[model samples]
Structure formats: structure tokens, C-alpha cells
Target: MGDLSTTDRTRHRRLREQGRTGRQELFDVLGAGFVCHLGVIVDGAPMVVPTVYGFDSEHVYIHGSVASRSLTGEGRTVCVTVTHVDGLVLARSVFEHGVNYRSAVIYGVPRALEGEEKLEALRLLTEHTAPGQWEYARRPNRKELAATTILAISLEEASVKIRQGPPDDADDPHDVWAGVLPLSTTWQAPVTDPSAGHDVPDHVRRRAGTRIG
Candidate 1:
């Protein structure tokens, strides 16, 4: 409900003013977006892979192909990040120019899930991408489930940061105009499949013209 307890790893050092320790802020950032970049070390080299994710109160779940190098290994620590760019803050000085955004970074050792847990994680992932999608779509079969890999990363160690408002160089006099160019993603009209001769579902229709992430 308030600020989250910070650990050594999650402590803010650089840009301390921008760091946030609230657990709810972390949840909001994660919930606002569907994609995340998963950072890990594979074969002594650093690898960052972009993937879709879902989260509960305590854990974040990411899934991929069973043979994926990023998800196969167990007991491996990884970093997952979700970010939403809200706008561009144009400033009188280039050095002061920045972006309005919300972001979260989570650090934890990933654990592979099996059986019902795996299926449930997949459901969460789908629903996260599009609410009510899991119920509307067909459930995965045994063969499909067997070919997928799901990893759970704990949310115990994480950090959140948010930036907003007009440029900081408001006091600096400049001939050029300065302001925030706000940005947002919105769902367009639904494109129906040619094979499926049915109208868009009510749930899908409700998302039309709505802002996303």
C-alpha cells in the first residue's frame, strides 16, 4: 500500500531523486504493460531477450519455447524490466531533455514450473496480454503445453521509477518552445478474421478506442 522495503541490491544510488520504493508503484508499472525484457547470462555472455510476461502479487511469470536458452535453465538469477513511455519532455537544453515514463526492474532467481502450475501461468500470461482472452480462446492441449516453458521470478527485490510533467528547464529562458509531447497507445477497431464469420466479442469490442499500456 505504501513504500516497499529496499534491499542492498534494490537501493537507489544514481538518480536517487527519481527512484521509488513503493510496492504498489511496481505493480502498476507491471500491470500497465504486457511485454518485458528479460536479462540473463547465458554461456558466459550477457543476453537480453524481449518476451511477454504476467505477474501476481509475489511473482512474475514469463514463458517461451521449451528449448529457449533464456528459460530452460533453473536456479539462475535474472532481471526483468517493464517500461511505459508516457511522453517526451522537450527542454530548452538538450542535456535537460528527458522522457516521461513508468518503469520497473525485478531481480530474482527463476524457477521452472510444471503440471498445473505451468498451465495456470500460461493462462495468466494470456489474460495479461488481453483481459478475458484465456476464457474466450481455446485452452492449450497436452502437446502444446509440453512444448512450452514457463519460468517464475520472485518480486521480492525490485525497484520502480516514474518521471512526469513539463521540462525541468522551465526557468531557463530559451527562444524555443518547451513542453511535454504526451504519448499513448490505443486499441484500434477490431479486425475480424476472414475464416471466422462471427462478429467481435463484447469483451473485445469494449477495448476498442481504449488506451493501452
Candidate 2:
């Protein structure tokens, strides 16, 4: 895969060393996570929405209710951001303390998909979050499809930054010890609803103990 370009919007002017290169790095960061923050301008004001997103070779897809004003953003461009906190970087001094993380900021004009493409995008969204849920659960019907809107934003322009490793203040003369406190997310046991009375399916049950981004 080609390395992503560092354009005006994407170029990291500060903390240049922390900026990541290549499109594959972007894919890794996005593929490991299921949620994103969508930023847009709506009704002459700024609105940031927490939403689920999926990405493929060329685009990142976000969806919501057809009636959502934020989804139908007033302007052409929107920003989608995904971040994963890996650890806390403890330093000898508070000023040097930081977080170890992977983040991506994508900017593009969203194009609403339709018909079969929209359905495909929805499936992508489902499979991205829960690998086999699309096939395991009931698929969306016509009316449900009509009430949903999926927007695909191009991946052509995106900014990715990754910070890792131990504290940068390891050599500090201060007496306080510095280290990294790791953090992670993992899948818990699947719960069965009493009303449904259905046993846990293989696909859902298999996710237990799995680590997430």
C-alpha cells in the first residue's frame, strides 16, 4: 500500500516525530476500533457526535437515522476521529506526563449511498463491529433500511498519529520513578436475556476474553 500524503491539513507541524506514515497504519488503527467521533457543522453551529464507523480500501462509512440533522451536515466536509488509549506515560515531572495512543483524523465530503450499496455499507458496519453478527442476526428489512442513512467519506485525505513506548523522562535526575501503566479492552462473557431465553450462539460466545483496541 502507498504511504499517505502529508498535505496542509495532515502535516504534523508539532510533534512531527509522533506522526505516522503509510495508509496501512491508518487501516490498522481503524480496524482495531469500532467507534468514532463525527464532527460537523449543523444549523450554523458546531456539533460533534459519537458514532460507529467502518472503513475499507477507499472510504470510511458512518451512518445514523435519516432524520438526524447532524448526519445531513450543513456543509460539504466533515471530520471523523478514532482514538485508542494504550497506556499512561508517567514521567518524573508532571509537564512531561503523556498518554500512549493511536489516533486518526479523517477529513472529506460525505456522499450518501443508496440501494444495494447502502445495504452493503450497513453490512460492513455490522461486520466491522461484531464479526459475524450480520449473518447471525436478522438482516434489516425495507422499512428499516429506509429510515437509515449511510455516508461514505473518502479516505484520500487523513491524518494519523501514534505515540508509544515508556516515558520520555527516563533519564531525568528526579528521584520519582517513571513508567508506563498499560490499559486495554477485552470482551466479557455474553449475557443471555431472560425474555428471549435463547442460549448464547457460538459466534457471540467466542468473543469472550478477546482483546479489543
Candidate 3:
């Protein structure tokens, strides 16, 4: 794929070395994570809300309660950020200590979805959160769907940044050790519901012992 088209706002002015211009890099950063911090203005104050998000090739979807103030407005500009910390970069000096991570920042005005589009967005959200849970579990009903709000933001304008490898304090001749302490997330054993007296579905079992993100 071609590099992502950059706008004035999306341009990487600082830390140009860490900025990634590939469209596939942006998609990979977003796809690997399940949660995002949504930055928006609410009631004349800046609010950053942490929530789950799902994405297709062109758009990212976020859902919340119908009464949520952040989701009430249409055509309002919002910033979404997703980040994954891969490791802690320990260095000889305190100032050189840093984190190795992959992150994506998206800027767009979101639009509310209705009818079938809304329902499909919900499915995408579900499947993204838990890959096979959507088909294994019960689908939402009419009343349940009525109480939820879904917003779709175009992924046309976004930026990706990634940092990796050992600490950059090679110039410092300190005896202190410097290395990367890697981190990862994995799915533990399934915890069955007490009320549901049935065997765990094969789809659910398949995710156990697997790494997430």
C-alpha cells in the first residue's frame, strides 16, 4: 500500500525519526489494540474518555450510551489515540529512560449511524473486542439497541509512531546495565459464568493461551 496522505495537522514536526508514514502501519497500530482514548470538548471543557473501539478499512467506530454528552454532537471534531507499550527501556541515566511503544493518533469529525449501519457497527465492535463472542453469544435486541449510540469516524487523516530497541545511552560509559524489558498481554483460562450451566464453546476455548495485541 501507498504511504498515508498527510495534512497540515497530521504532519510530524517533532521526533521525525519516530513518525511512520505508511498507511499499513497506521492500520496495524489501530488493529492491534482494543481500547482508545477519545479526546473531545464537552460543555466548554476538554474531556478525554477511555473506551473500546473497532475499525474497518476506512472507518473507526465508537459506542456509548444514548445519553452520553460526548456522543450527542454530530460533525464534531474528535481525536482518538491508541497505544501499546512493548517494553521499558532502561538506561544508564534517568533522563535516558524511555518506553518502547507503538501508537496511532486519528483526527476526524464523527457522524452518527442509523438503522442497519448502526447494528453492523455494533457487530464490528463486538467482534473486535472478543473475536468469536459475537457469534457464540446472544445478539442485541431492539430495546437494547435503542439505548445505545454509535459514531463513525473516517480514518483518512491519521499518524502512527513507533519506538523500539535497547536504550540509546551508548555514549554514557556507566557500569549500569541497559536493556529492554519486554511486556506482553495474553488471554488466561476462561472463567465460565455461574448462571450459564453449559460447556464453553469451541470458539471461546480457541482464544485461551493466545497473545492479545
Candidate 4:
């Protein structure tokens, strides 16, 4: 079974209470983004590093260089967070102005993967980042796999918060206009590198209109 008890570190806040706390909301927020900020502790010092991650129903997988001292060292726990800002809620009142966004914060211990599980985890990571790119690209070799360090964190302790639509203001008779300015990120045409000797493939060209994921 998946872990449903968040460490409380991922709980919702009053200001963002319009936020959602369901599992689907959490998964959507996390799955919609590829980058995550990983917070770790080293020698009594705390460090937050930005990295890419992939998640399944049970675990969130992260990979970094095998030589990374932070990942290979002693500490077992880490905090991973992914966020997406959908729009800017511009209110007449400065205090009422806010942002429309979806965010997920995950807290758990990093567990190492080995053998076949490692390969599958890597596949999940790659496919999660880009839908069809994994099958089109080259797969990893044994030596490459050995050189990478992958850790899986159970999805037990996590939370999701989301804010959407317009800003709210008390019925002040003389307040200026207030509403939400929708914001969205879309993909542009893929430009091939100079080194490319032939026309771009269908998969690369098909990325146009692909929303940020």
C-alpha cells in the first residue's frame, strides 16, 4: 500500500487552503513537473539542491552522479518539492494579490535501488520527464547504470496545495478592479542543433503545443 500519512511538513496552510489535499491532486502536481528541489543534511548543515525526479504510485525516484558526496554520504532522509505557477492573481489591494499555483512537497528517507528494480526505476524516471522520448533515445548500458546513483522515497509523507481562478477581496465599495491574469507555458518549435546532418524526426517536431511537463 502507498503511504498516506504525510510528515506534517507537507500540510496545507490557511492562506493556501483553497488548495487540495487529495492523492490525485498531489500526483497531478508532481507529475506535471520534472524538476524538484531536494533538501538534504550534511555534517549538521542543510543543503537544497535542484534535481529532476520521477514518481510512481508507491515511490519517488531521484538520480544524481554516483560521485555526489551528498547522496552517497550518511544521511538517509530528504525533502523533495515540485511546483507549478499557473497564473498571477492581481487584486486591487496589494495585500490581496496572490499567485495561482499547484505544488507538492514530499518528505521521506532515500532508499537505494539495485538490479532489475534499478532499471525499471530509471525507465520510470525517463518516461515521466518526457512521454515518448525514452523509447526513441538510446537506453543505458551496464557501465552507465553502475555510474549513476538512484534513490527511491516512499510517497507516504507528502502534500499538495493548489490555488486557481481570481483574487478575493472584501466588498470595499471604492476598490479598484481585481481579477486573475491567466498564465500558461507552451512549447515552441524544436530547433535542431547544427550538428544534425538530416531533417528533424517526427517525435521532435511533434512537441509543438506540448504544455510544460
| RMSD (Å) per prediction | 1.8, 1.6, 1.6, 2.4
**Lowest lDDT block of 10, candidate 2:** 66-75
Give the number of the best model, judged by lDDT: 2
Which ten contiguous residues of candidate 3 have the minimum total lDDT? 64-73
- TM per model? 0.93, 0.95, 0.94, 0.89
lDDT of each: 0.86, 0.88, 0.87, 0.78
**Candidate 4 residue spans exceeding 4 A from truth:** 1-3
Per-residue alpha-carbon lDDT of candidate 1 for residues 105-175, written as tens digits (9 for 90 to 100): 99998887999999988888889987898998888899989878888888989999889889888788676
Q: List the residue pairs that clash in candidate 4.
A: 3-156
Q: Indicate whether candidate 3 or candidate 4 has the larger TM-score.
A: 3
lDDT (tens digit, per residue) of candidate 2 on 149-182: 8989989889899999988877778988788999
lDDT of 2 at 155: 90
With a 3 Å backbone cut-off (N, CA, C), the pairs that clash in candidate 2 are none
lDDT of model number 2: 0.88
Q: Write the per-residue lDDT of candidate 3 for residues 123-150, one digit (tens) a residue.
A: 9988998888888888989998887888
Residue 45 deviation, candidate 4, in Å?
A: 3.5
**TM-score between model 3 and native:** 0.94
